[model samples]
Target chain A: MTQRLKTPLKEDDISSLKAGDEIILSGIIYGARDAAHKRIIESINSNQKLPFELKGSVIFYVGPSPVPPGRKSGAVGPTTSARMDSLTEPLLKKGLMGIIGKGDRNNHLRKLMQKYKCIYFIAPGGISAFLASKIKDIKEIAYNDLGPEAVFEIEVKDFPLFVAYDIQGNNIFELALRRE
Target chain B: MKIIKITKIKNQIKKLIKTASFNLPEDITDSIRQACSAEKNNTAKKILELILKNSEIAAKKKIPLCQDCGNVYIDIKIGENICIEKFSFLQDMADEAVAEAYKENYLRKSIVSDPLFDRINTKDNTPAYLSIVPADTLDGLEINVFLKGGGSENCSFLYMLTPSDSADAIISKVLDAVRQNVTKSCPPVIIGIGIGATSSKVTELARKAAFRNLKIRNADDKYKILENSILEKINNTGIGPAGLGGMTTALAVNIEYMPCHMATLPVAVSFACHSLRRASSKILLP
Candidate 1:
């Protein structure tokens, strides 16, 4: 029998997600990629408050295309999560519960996720159109000059994703790719 | 000879970029449809269906086929007899086209100014990887544009093998490379193999091989035969869609070959993920 997660996940709720589990994530997710991550980390190191609280938050590693006429954003899809590995530990320490991105995370990051009870979810790469449908709205929160790389608070409802890395440090990518 | 205005060429290139990004090319879509029907595993079949559906959504709604619109690669084959007033100004015109397309079309500006340090976004996707080839004919130009996404591009590998390396060894190395890099490169990949060439030529041939429509067969009989065999072996790995473990890990394997030094066997593997956004145009300059 398959397990279904309750919607609007809390910090403790992250523990329920496991590698290979399918999830329909709802609520708020902040968008950040490389440039935005560096800024966020700088703010953290400087003992300044982050633009949004990290507690129970899910950060999507995406740099979206510009919004077309009559659209909120264009072609928003997960980028490689491993690019953000350097910035993840601090954010996880601050109570980030989940990350949504494509590709693998390193073992050290997986260990941090385990220690912090966070989950790493993957949306289908290159399925930008499908992924964009799940996004309800987006509001630029900071670094507006960064264009597509700006930080935005995104609202989503039932955004489908699969858990690639779970709270127990199990990585579905590693498990699935291991040579028999 | 009438001189073609740089601005006019720029506009056409911009339109091409937008059209190529918004529309999933028919050949690639058809290939996915065939792969979906032929895929044996239930899970892999479902994933292929989703990919097809995603392509539909991208076309109907005019969304970018993928978030990574990729660095613009424009291969220009200029006619031998055609004359340009300012021959060297072509690159500037192409850069302007890239900027306009990336901005006006809502495409992501993915290019960076420097590779090692100060990794700053160029804001507009300028500095296209432009290659100029002299055309054999007298009256027309041919332009081939490919939006090469980094995910699949990163998975590419080059191997310098001894002449003694058997077909089996080549196949094994290619499979192992894909298997090792599966999660990193988005799955349901199209593998392009270039065999029997110098290192640089192998790399070029691998990319050229990837641009061949999945439905087409290599004219060379040996290469066509090897393409099918390699495709079968890759799918047999069961990496599946998105590396979730299924039978349809590879959609196709296209191979291009060139004569190499007798003692050296260079093989290059290039990967194209499911999106595969590429197109070509031929312009008649009368």
Candidate 2:
């Protein structure tokens, strides 16, 4: 059965999730791609304030196109999550609750998710137009110089996603591939 | 013969760019619809539905089918006997069209100035990968445009094997590559296999094979048999719609082959996701 999750998801809430579970997310999530993730990690290492708080918040790894007239953002879809695996350790340390992207994560990242009591979600890749309909609002937070790679504060409503990784280090992709 | 100015060519290129970007080809849409109906897994079915719906939304709303609009590739077949005022000016005309298309249609500017460094978005999808081929008959130019996204492009593979390698070996490697690349390249993939050629020719044929209608099979009987067999094996993998584990792993498998060197057998595989964006137009001479 499917479940709905609200953002600022607590550590306990994430712990309850498991691989193969379907989720519909609502509330605030931050958008950060490769460049923005690097910048955020640099801030954390220097003991400085991040552009946005990571605790209990969801981070979506996407670089959206420019918004047309009278639109929130253009086709915003999940990029390859594996690319962000290197910066995941520090972000989990800062209490990141969940992540939304496509594709499989490395074993180390899965272990980190379990260790930190977080969950990983997979939004359908290449369905940007449908995904865009779920986004209610968007505001740029930092890295404006990076164009689409800039970090943005996004508010979504009933945004459909699937649980790929849970607190127990279970991976849906691994399970599915193994069954084949 | 009518003299078509460079500006007219520029406009034609611009319109082709927008048309290919905003619209998913009819054959691909039909394939996705059929896959959605046949898909057993509820999750995979749902993902396919979303993809189909997304394409419709993108078309009606005049937005890109995907954010990474991809590099523009133009294939032009020019007739030898056609008289043109300025034959060499076509490349400049196409580049201008790319610049205008990106600015006017709000398409993403994905091209970079250099490959090694200065990895910057040109802010205009300019410097199109244009190829001009001569045709036997005297006629107007025919253009085929393709917008290839980065994700699927990254999954392309080429293998060089000894002539002694059996057909089974080729099938095994291709299947292995697909299994390894499930979600990364997106599922319900259209696979193109180019066999029996040099390394570069194999790669080129692999890409060219993808542009063929998915419903069509290879002309050669042996290759057709191989294509069908491989298609069956791929679907049985159950990678599903978006690798969530389902019945349909691929939409179609197209194979193109050519003569090869005596000692070597080269094979290239190119994959395209559900949103195969390609269009062709023909201009006939009077």
Measured by lDDT, the strongest candidate is 2
Pick the DockQ winner. 2
TM-score of each prediction: 0.92, 0.94
B121: Cα error in model 1, Å: 1.3
Q: How well does model 1 score by local distance difference test? A: 0.81
Candidates' lDDT values, in order? Answer: 0.81, 0.83
Best by TM-score: 2
For residues B1-286, could you state the per-residue lDDT of candidate 1 as single tens digits? 5466666666678878887898878887887788788777665676677778788888888888888899898888888676655668888888989998888877888887897887678898879988888877747777788888877888889999999988888889988998777666677888889998799989888887887788788898877888899888888877778777677788788998999999999999998888888877766777
Q: Candidate 2, chain A: TM-score? A: 0.96
| Deviating ranges (above 4 Å) for candidate 2 | A177-180, B1-3, B83-85
Model 1 earns a TM-score of 0.92
Clashing pairs in 2: none
Distance (Å) between predicted and true CA of A139, model 1?
2.5
Scored against the true structure, residue B138 in model 2 reaches a CA lDDT of: 44
lDDT tens digits by residue: candidate 2, B38-135:
87777788888888899999899877788777778888877756655686888877888888887888776766567666556666777898888888
lDDT of candidate 2 over A30-138, digit per residue (tens): 9998778988999999999899989999999887766788987677788778888898999999999889988887788888888988788998777887788888998
